[model samples]
Target: MPAFALEAEQRKWCEELRTLAARELRPLADAGEEGRINRELLAALGELGLLGRLFAPDGRPASALDLCLLRESLAYSCTEAETALALQGLGAGPVALAGTDGQRARWLTEVTAGRAVAAFALSEPGAGSDAAALALDAEPDGKGAGHGWRLTGSKTWISNAPHADVFTVFARTVKGAGSRGVTAFLVPAGRPGLGGEPLEMLSPHPVGTVTFDGVPVTRDDLLGEVDGGFGVAMRTLNLFRPSVGAFATGMAQAALDAAVEHAGTRRAFGGTLRDLQSVSHQLAETATRVEAARLLVYAAAAAYDRGEPDIPRRAAMAKLLATETAQQAVDAAVQIHGAAALQRGHLLEHLYREVRAPRIYEGASEVQRSIIAKELYS
Candidate 1:
């Protein structure tokens, strides 16, 4: 695909996704309880074969471009669906990337089919952005060489937590080793001593806190080499970061479209809102910013697809700019829509709430800037 323009097939696929989200996913999302996982939406995605696209059944890693397209297209019409798809990819990414054949066969298929929910358990009470500072302790169970570890700690701000059928949990294995000490574990939800509670959040997504009380895992639960989980987490983030930007871009575009339509139709000062120079210029600027952000997101996704070495910097730049731009675009859209935008159930109102969280989650804008600077210096 071109950096600036999607190919014909890509555009057609995006259109299909948009249609599916609007016609099928949006209803399920609307019927879903806020702050909870929508299993019906997941099942719909699975039925559409959209979930299967997140990872290759042939064992190849999912394409970054494909992921971005899926997110952007779905987000344009149904953010809940987009989030469900992204969470599946984010949580099960490590398994697809480096899990043993048994692990992949067991979890990945179920995840794709929406028969099982997955959660990425990396953040803790003290370790939001500083993932390496995670305090989840995983002590050896002392069952000899092939024995499993005992996990005992708490993980908060975990997406799809408590309710998810499985979790890719990160725990500290080596004392005082920092990043190198962290190891990834695949823990099934019903294990003894594993429990969690839902956390009500500004974004209407399934987020919660999970507690591990001497949770035991066997060798089969390990993801990748022990004490090498940091790489696994980083790899998944790097792959998904650009798609995060794509998600933001889609929201921005939706807001822009809303603003444009409202401006053309709503009369103000004896004319339509679009007749005002201020409104027109603001919309123009917002549209331009959205387009630029979209380009950056596409470029970053393309770079990742090409296996470029500068993906860290590119992905950071894309996510930072796109998320910030989305916030701006959504705000401007609300502003242009005036009091109606703030009313309950308004599209702009929903977007206003949705746009703020992306800048904070995945990686904060400050964190993205830090990544870009670090990549530059390195």
Candidate 2:
């Protein structure tokens, strides 16, 4: 399938997204750049319905192709902003898929309007790759009490914790059952006893630890049913994981762009760098790997758009292969740049750090490999 099959109008929208991002976000990545998701840029996206693009104009579930196209283009220029926007989509996406119409109209509306930021709160200090190992606890509140559920536990390394106005918190239901006992909650941040502490990482993205010390949640916010959260979270990932691949695609594209420019302009051995077989071969290899990765990602995304049966396996494969290839491509770009790209401020070096996070989060490389292997064997 074509990487993207777009009408002229959608093509214009994609161009606008890329052009606006470069004009606005590119400068934020330079010189001690916090790369924070600035308010104005976000509002601009909201104004164009980019923030609210997941839903169709008819107000139903969004087309997968549209989601992928917007995310892939956004990822190319600003990885952090891309991630932030993704968090907004993902945090409320589960409820949209599984929640009552009221839930989507309530939480998702604010998020799409840019009035609130949304986040998914599933990862814990101990449950990095093994999602089933999650240990946060949520028990039914006494019937006489005002609240329906009381959550008590700590979740570490959560994105948007510090800034999130609302979060989709997951917790264990009870001990008797395994996956059945796990439940998901829509918990607002700063609800009395909740706590958030920022985490420092290689990339300058917003991350923090969240703790719920007897946080109250209304029964109305329970996504799906008790223990139904497993499917909710998994299905959500199955849909959004390809965007992680898109982030990888962006890194690879950026790296390849840098390398090609350097190869044509830089001189060695009385010739342009590309004149050498070693450099040319590397260029060819980078190009080939990037195209391969792009195809894999696009195929998986296409499957999602088509409602194919094997989307989980396809998405996992796409996420893993695309990210690894993108990393390799970026590394090659850094190598090709020699010393110039090694500078801390260089785009390749910045992308080198930015790309590493995707491998570790949203289902790690090893985790996806295991999932794919299990699917293949079973």
Candidate 3:
């Protein structure tokens, strides 16, 4: 096999994951209530030992390529399972990367075991793509011997907000410092003054809003250096962005497979759909795009694993291209399937909804373009 291709072991692992997802995870995902945390699915992930793979145990960083492969394989058969795994990594990433040994011992183990749900709370009502502009304030706790801070603000669109056992919350610690003022805190769900409510969304996931009305945090809660949380957040995003692209590519592959299968069987105008030049050409274009996107995703993941300096540009390009391509591929799949694809519970219908959110989250396509352009000039 070429260097770009998956090694035999990697290919076998991916196939096993797909089989596990289809046979075990997909049923739990289907039974899960929309907009709610699927603890059962998470527990299943832990039971299968897959959750432990998200973090390296030897005091080394997790491989970005492994992350991408896991996500893509799980996403190919069970997007809900893939999402549960990714959310755990995203929420606990700061702690896994920068938390104190005590913090790691307290949270990381439980997170890996799926006994504790975690959330990454960075985006606020005013922040979103402008993450540095987050307004959640963490004022010094004057009455707590100056050893703690009181958090007061709201975070919107936080995945696993309402149900997560702990959250890596970002708040402003120094006024007028822009990104430098931010601090990341590990706030437990039962903390006083911390509250959350679920938000209904088109996609089936546990995303919601969190409100912090003077939630108190001590030095122990800090995930990284105070006033330097932005770096931690960026590092996590930089690592995961390409995997997000891989996730999108997996969905694209599934959609392409469905389209190809349908075209080969479904007849139109006295002949099979694949016999038509127009239908065949559309499928061909989508297949080419999906392969290109997958290659870009693989390259970005490999670069990240290698500790390459141009990771930001490569990751942005991978995510932007793959997500946009997934949307197009899924849309084309729907077009070929016609009205049957629109029916509830259809694979194409589910993918149609799932593929759109990736383009918007983990930094939008516009933000990605800006990052790439900046990298090019620098």
Candidate 4:
């Protein structure tokens, strides 16, 4: 690889992934319910060894660059599969990062095998992007539960909630501690007071609110030390942030490709749409922005893999640029395709819906800007 460009093998692998997503994964995604977990699709990813790649073949974690490539390639042809794969990583990532051997042996195996689902339960209704402001209380259990704590509160907008077999939950273990008081726990779905309800959203993924009515967890269930959960969450997000950009870049590339093809072939006033200076110019700009976003994503991912200190800033820049560019590219595609793009089942329509949420989730665009600004001064 020439510093910024992908190596030949990497490019070949990405092409293969795109083809596999289109041919093997798309059908499973098409058959799944709009807002439900697609177990079949997940299973297909596992069977193809995509899920296992979340961790490396040597039991060590995979590189951030590998994650970006996988996500981008999958998103290029099948956003649903990309989302499913990403969620698996997001929800179970902490375990691979800080979990005990027992926890890894139990959940990570099932997770990678597609037999067990996992969720990262960090965002509460009151704490969306303000992670440190979370108020889920973790009071000590006094019912002879032996070093256990009782978690009481609710988490909203959690991906794969109400259905995940396990959750890496964050809660406030000490009052007045801000981020310092938070703790991470691995709580199974069937815990005594654990329950959840699915929420309908604009994007087609399983998101919901989980209510913890004094859910019990022991020290054995803790992920990392008490009050160390915030670090765990941040580490996971730092690694994933650039890959989120990769996801957006893939979507943008797809939209740009569609727009270019349409402009080249779709008839308009006396000639093909490409002959129109207005249409061609818009495409030229969109293509440039998309490529720039992809390069930024690659750089950020590479920085993360290199264990550089400025990862936060790079990740934020990559995500902010790529996601914003994806929205623009999709909108431009829809505009070029005109009303036909708005029709049901149109590729542009699906992308139009899919493109809006990345801007909001996993730390919104506004939040990304804040991080970048803070990091610059620090």
Give per-residue CA lDDT, model 4, range 256-306, as digits (tens). Answer: 999999999998899999999999999999999999999999999998888
TM-score of 3: 0.98
> lDDT tens digits, residues 132-153, model 2?
7788878678866454877888
lDDT per residue for candidate 3 within 220-329, as digits (tens), equals 89988989899999999998999999999999999999999999999889999999999999999999999999988998999888877888999999999999999999
The 10-residue segment of model 3 with minimum total lDDT is 53-62
lDDT of each: 0.92, 0.79, 0.92, 0.93
Q: After TM-score superposition, what is the CA distance of residue 77 in candidate 4 from its true location, in Å? A: 0.6
**Residue pairs that clash (backbone atoms under 3 angstroms), model 4:** none
- Where does candidate 1 have its weakest 10-residue lDDT segment? 56-65
What are the C-alpha RMSDs, in order, of all predicted structures? Answer: 1.2, 2.4, 1.6, 1.6
Model 1, stretches more than 4 Å misplaced? Answer: 1-3
Clashing pairs in 3: none
Residue pairs in steric clash, candidate 2? 173-181
Of candidates 3 and 2, the better by lDDT: 3
Which run of 10 residues does model 2 get worst, by summed lDDT? Answer: 28-37
RMSD of 1: 1.2
Kindly give the number of clashing pairs for every candidate: 0, 1, 0, 0
